[model samples]
Target: MRRQTQECKEYMEAGEKYLDCQDRQLTSVMQDWPKDINHLLLARNKIQVLRDNMFSQFTQLKSLDLQQNDISMVEDGAFSGLSQLTTLLLQHNRLKTASEEVLLPLPRLTYLRLYDNPWSCQCSLDSLVRSLQLPSNRNLGNYAKCAEPLLVVGQKLKKLSVDSLCRDDNQVDRGTGGGDGGRPRLPLIKVKPEATSMCHTYVFPKLLLDCSNKDLDHIPSDLPSDIVKMDLSSNIVKHLRPKQFLLSKDLKLLNLSGNSLRHIDTAAFAGLLYLRELDLSNNSLHYFQYGVLEDLYFLRKLSLGNNPWVCDYNIHYLIYWLKHHPGVSYTGLMCSEPQEFRGWRVEDYVKTYNGECPKDRQTGGMDTGQGGQGGSDNEAQEVAGETGEQLPRPLREKKRNRFEIIRLS
Candidate 1:
């Protein structure tokens, strides 16, 4: 092992393959590091921004420790050329946001420590959040948390609803130039304090309303009609009446998780034709009306996890709907009732039941297999219950020992 100067010490161990420069009060990385060094410790330094290709010379590096530093910004491609890197420690830093481009180069990375940094929750972090959801990074879920946007200050980043992080690019007009070249701009409309007290709204550029965790009994009635996204999770909303969202026709995302929603009327979401995502997890819902979700033709993502679902003939409609719409991504639609079907995934339940309702019960002349092809929408609604017959094959798959649903309630 070779030791450097007194202020900055460098030692090599295990045949000159490891380097330790920790607690050296260094402001920048040493350019003279051994090219063969496989482990480098630079924690407790004064390093700020990480410029692009800063570690390009450390091609053989397998583990890099930079924790407890003052690193706030990591320029795109800063970690290029460290393809062999397997472990990276970046905890306890000043990083507020991380982009996918910054971490995409480390294909061999198996362990990453990114906790203790202040993270800003916004559209810019959407890519990072999605990348972390991959099965390979599932272990990092608990280590990531939001530090800004007070509404979700201490919540885990992975647990945050996707709608909260994704913002519609077209809704926000970012360009300063107007149609009339260089004309004088009109006075801006100042938002009132009352609006802020009810919910946080960003009026400039575009409108975003956040009313989550506010203990609200109902949706705010004074919101602007053009608002693009709204979060109403963790509240006391019990029921959704007809045309409940008529005023917010332009809303593209809605979050109603962790609420006391026991009933949702047929036309509860009638006016939200453009809604792209909806979260109804962690509620008291037993069954959704047969056609309650038919209007959400544009919805691409839906979360129905952690609810007490009654898996009976009433649930056949949902199964039929899910089977036909392969484009929709959903999670946690498992059975919680009906002793025979408990814990079975909704999709599996549909397959096991084969759209056949129990013969002993009456279905009020409703179609159990609504999404089957060759059946018109009118036929789907008018068909009566299945004839009393033998049950379809039961699910022979092993039951899940632990549910993956997140309990927000």
Candidate 2:
């Protein structure tokens, strides 16, 4: 069979079972999609809404790309018949809420992208949030950021706790009473003390907190005990103390991106045993102690991009960790120091360094050099001679005589 490309506002590459209708100003799904098509690309269009049974005919479809559209609504049963679908991309849309009825039908879906949507955090979205929490659909958590309700703007949806969404239910008045002058009065219910203590709002019935861009200088001490997700991005916090998050042991997702953080204690993340994703991007970190991340056995995704990483021998700690954990997404990680290795990827640099200390640096014995001061007994240090910025105080405390590159036993 010869390969063919069909052109008609939308085009299809025949014999390959692929269709490309992107950037065609489409307002709806094209009904003339070839019955044998297995992949469809409909991104960058004007699709405003998804109607019921829209893709019912494409039972064999395996991948659907609808990113960068104007989709605001997805009617129930809209995705009912695409049982073979394994990937769905819906980023950069106008969706306000996603109900389980629109998502539960695609049982084989293994990858879903729903970021950049104006998700209204409320009880209406609780079911969809719960569906995404299932182990089978957990990877979708990385693309579930919210873009609404003022408080949680730019916060990931999966980080939200159920208490944040359902706390409003506690405010409903259920008492039936008679008022003065024979007028019936609606009951007045008091807000929960937990909800009143923090400057957060609900996204799913008490599961997530949208605390992004709150100008907070420190973690809120009064956060709910059972809260699972917290967004502390775009804040002014400079340090992370060990006790700051001592009570948030159940936290699964933490976003500390776009902050002024320069120091993180080794014990700062001590109790976060259940943490899955952490975003420390766009900060002022030059080096991070691997000990801080040692306790996160379940961590799958970590974002350390957009920071001014020194990329010296000291960075071996992070590179070694990243190489061992292939599942972590270390995007935007680049070197910003060392004239020789600048602009190189930290991971790539680690390959070239090969766990060897510089020829001039002392390696056989602990030398309290310029970079080794205040370091702990086990940390390895390398000097870049004032390349970009000095390492933070907490990170400079650990000194090691030799570069012990992690080797899987």
Candidate 3:
């Protein structure tokens, strides 16, 4: 009989290990994979249903890519043991309905891509919708719309009210986390003295804690966990430490505009998986450090106007990130440094950064003219110097794995 399954092996990227099974027409995961794999790529496959405990062995898995598949149903315990999973991609599938229980095992999930799926917004989907609509989960289910039920068809799943989905009004009311409700409530934290004394707390019309113009150079300790919005604009805070907002997991909007902010740590926004709107306008930031924006997986709107943005390869990371995330709308990214590129748009400058040299300079190999002999090398070095880095090598080239079997002579 022809072989229908292959041994699960390893793949390498940037010196890290992962399992790559992309573009394979398989229906299920192959057996004998290492239990310690941190990344798994299974895109472009024919896998339909996810049975229970399908990935229970990979306890150390951190990211799982299941995009571009025919997956329609996921059993409740399919991901039962993936407690360390932080990123899950289930987009471009045939999932019509799912329960919050399916996601209970992924407590640390930071980036979830559920868009491009045909979601059915009916009574059975109320629980999932309610969970996504919570203030702490604002970044979870994005761009997911209903495909069934004519009345709610095409409506976003995050905005659909639970009362309208179910016929029983009392059940819907209880589901809203009222007294004796099924959903657990977030623990109430006592507002610290420093926070209460400096910030103005407002609960009506939405919970907003305004700490703007506080004339403070540091953030207050023990911020209220239930606040949905915070205003810390026009402050003198210059540096952001790592995990500064770790306790503010429920924040959906934050304004740090008009501050003297010049440096931001890479993990300054960690544990803020649900933050959607951020304002950093009128700051002194020239460029962001690599991976500074890594934790903001769901940010939708950013205000970067009036910042002194420099035109260099160091600034390209921000533009590259924005290009990949077209959902995020930003403003004021004109180059203000390196006089020659001043007044130029950041995107236009990035295009010129990759421009090639003239053909004449490249073809001056044997000519005894002014640009002969070592002209190409000089020009290449000049180009590299201008870009602040050398050319990148191809990292995605595919190579066939070789295997050898030995027998006793």
Candidate 4:
């Protein structure tokens, strides 16, 4: 017992308590365990049977890993008090049967793994099969197959008909076929490609998804709705189609930096109402079209660095929207456009849009001398005022003649 205890590793991760007792050859859970642990792992053990009240002490446990064990039978009350348990893994075990009543104590169970087990397909396993096939239990017992009754061997338990398990003819209505209960067959669900198989998924510390550096040319379909943060940076996504992120309504932080993004449809972010931080840096973006950012009402920070932002009339909308939303802190919006305005701040370029100068103090008239030098002086003064600095006279002269057209005599 002392050697087994020494093999177990108990530690705190991100302020959550965890106890890992995997590969300790534990036949049963030890009594010397902290009651406040949030995660408990007991995989690759020699556990055969689960007695009544097997884990009643760990009331606060959120996840239990018991895969690759010798567990064959589980008493009905084995998980009696695990009210907060959300994840349970029982795959690769030696079990042939399990009653649905054994899961009654796990009220919050959302993720259940029961695959790779020798499941018996008989009258006794009817209730468990029916429970696992419920539409609401789609994530439970996935990939589990029936191993007994040669007629239905290797059949997926989730797609198995409940009528085939029980022998009573009055229980289920018969279909066109013969010997079996003849229940109407359910069509197999079409498997859609998902990014979860390729990317890393983290459940604790805030449900994060990392799909960066995947060489993706488009956003992956069917993103999880509960993810709070997603990183899709350093890819080849060039266009953001309409309603691209409509599924991930709970997203708070989105990192799309270091991509080849050039165009974003107006409704590309239609459902991102709660987005707090967005990173669009190091891309090939030019400007945002009107109404493209209409949905980000609660945005806090925006990163637009290292992009070739054109300082044209089309770029005015971005500055206009940011001005109205004073709460959003932004960076790196310099002009990389028409040679005259190259390297100018986007805010300063937008200020010169009106082209109206104030009346002179001494002459009481608009100073319209030398190729709209008056307007140039006003633009320079406004830029200086915004940054709390004075513009050099040479730079001001250079800007004054930028639009002047000389006629050959």
Candidate 5:
């Protein structure tokens, strides 16, 4: 019987058909079980134990699906020979960590899915976490949870610290705390620049930048002069000034999501001749001003969703603006405001002013004769919600568990 089992295993290694090892309740698998099996599907099985040399022979295995198993511990070097393996689906498993040495051999691997597993989020798991930080490795950050009571407190598997999340059984540390404990002393990784990133190669024409969490309280004074796209999401900015933008000639897409912007000077976006897409979603903007977008004649998309827009004398400007601008996409957006003005269009504010802006243009005499923001035309209106009252920040630092929906309230 042993000879027959070994023969079947070896037979599969010689480019023969594979075993139907589904739901086999395999408690212990042999090291040289099946060396030639190019494809293995051991999903929904009771396979609890896997040896280091278990798959050291399948050099050509491209796809291995070991999902939905009772695997608790995986030996080091278990998958040392899968150099060409591109897809590894280990979802719904009981395994905790896959060592660095074990994964160092997977040279051509690209996709790795290990979601819904019991991850300890320790330094012992640093190998897998470090594997993802490599510039050559693509799409490796999947479903990594911060375990619990740690720096990252949640379980959607976004990113686990390579050195902070895991334990170093091999090394000794004097730090006091449990595995996946202790605050991580690292900045959010910025892999590539917004415009020239290899990841942005596909979305080159429309790229997103991450100037957020760069510890910037104000917009950078030296932004790209001719950028077509910019993503300034997740930052701590309080207000917008005209000198902040230094507008680009071809600027089209701008993402200001997740910020502390309480006020925006309307004339701040003066030189954006080709501006089209603007995303102001998920912000602490308690006031809404139509003049910020007044000069954007070609502006097609504007996202004021997730903001507490109090309907005052000028709230009608937005409805008037919306009525004129068509084909704009609001991402599941809604307004939470005056019962009468609730769900109103951007063109609704036109009643207050006869197509003329209500801006206090007298304030711009000291600056450019054109005025700061909201200074473009004589028909401009003053910003409606710039009452020096600042609202509390809804988003916490790295607290991604909150509801990040920016809506018109």
Candidate 6:
């Protein structure tokens, strides 16, 4: 049995010239080291540590993989021996810090992957991102962020604007009371002197314009001609210009959820003959004319939940649309009816209050939508609570205004 086991091990090592240690339950040292090995994959091992000279014998190795490990640290010069190595994968690791000191030795490494790692967003990380963006720098841009306070989880590094991603850090720290000596820690805005993407345009792909708490007071005028999906979720827009909405030919999805939008042009969405989903939730709209949303023939998913809806005769028109539009979904929106008539549904609303609105009550601009401020981590908690509920007042206030489609020219 002992000889058979030894033979099995020998055959396992000799059976193939390349070894894939990825996702292997490798917790300890292996018994035999194979020669002439060119590729070594040790990813997803759940390894926390690497011993000295782990791969010293594989002198001909060209590619190495080590992803999805619990690796928080690397012993000094752990990979100093791989002279001909070109590709290295170290993504989804628990590395809090990785620097040139650990990587300056690899001469031939051209492609390296270190994305999806839990890198703490602090000044320490500043040096990392900057160095990575440098065209001449080595293996710096390979790493991606694991947790950003704003963007989706595990997003690619090259896709997101670093300025926007880093902006939330200072604001996040300020709310934690990390202030020194009683000084208020104002959030730091990420400044990108050169903010531009490689114009990889797809004819009006979905516009992921998440300008929540940005310095933009207006919209960029040069919207793509085939913008089928538009997301203006959080910005300080006061109004939608005629060119902003009316000119787009194939706008299918429109989201004006959180802005300062008080009113929309009755003809604001003239050219959007193919609009399907329209979200106007959490705005400063006290009244909406029926003609505003009438042209949306393809509009199926309509959201108007959090606006300070003054359940009046005008609401009857919107309710009439909702009652007929089977695809329309009104998620968790509420109305403050007169003292006696509260908690109204869309079906009954048009029946009893069609062309009928509450006139006597003097309407004041109530909390924009719900109590929510910008740049506060607590505001994130508040938004979490309103996920399917009313739109946060702060986000609503930013959407009311529009710009001349400001281009980055």
TM-score against truth, every candidate: 0.40, 0.43, 0.43, 0.60, 0.37, 0.37
Residues 1-409 of candidate 4 have per-residue lDDT tens digits of 1223447877888787888887897899878787888998887789999899989999999998887789899888999999999988787788898889988898889988776677888888888899999898877786677776655666778888888687752333233355456455444344433444345444545667778998888997757677899999999999999997998999999999999999999999999999999999999999998999899999999999999999889998999899999999999999999889999999999998754544321222323344246555665465457545454453244445334322211
lDDT of 5 by residue, 287-350 (tens): 5566776667787777777776655655655655666676555552344466766665434433
| Local lDDT at 349 for model 3 | 96
CA RMSD of each candidate after superposition: 19.4, 14.7, 25.1, 10.5, 18.0, 21.4
TM-score computed on alpha carbons, candidate 3: 0.43
Q: How does each model score on lDDT?
A: 0.72, 0.70, 0.76, 0.80, 0.57, 0.57
- Model 6: worst 10 consecutive residues (lDDT sum): 195-204
Full ranking by lDDT: 4, 3, 1, 2, 5, 6
Candidate 3 collision pairs:
none
The residue pairs in collision within model 1 are: none
- Best candidate, lDDT: 4
Candidate 1 minimal-lDDT segment of 10 residues: 384-393
Task: Give the Cα error of residue 380 in candidate 4, in Å.
Answer: 29
Give the range of the ten consecutive residues with the poorest summed lDDT in model 4. Answer: 359-368
Model 5, global lDDT: 0.57
* Candidate number with the higher lDDT (2 or 4): 4
Query: Best by TM-score, which number?
Result: 4
Per-residue lDDT tens digits for candidate 2, residues 37-122, read 77877777898889988988888888888877899999988898999988787766788887888877788887776765668777
**Model 2 CA lDDT for position 124:** 83
- Count the clashes in each prediction: 0, 26, 0, 0, 41, 30
Segments of candidate 6 deviating more than 4 angstroms: 1-212, 354-409
Single out the weakest 10-residue window by summed lDDT for candidate 5. Answer: 196-205
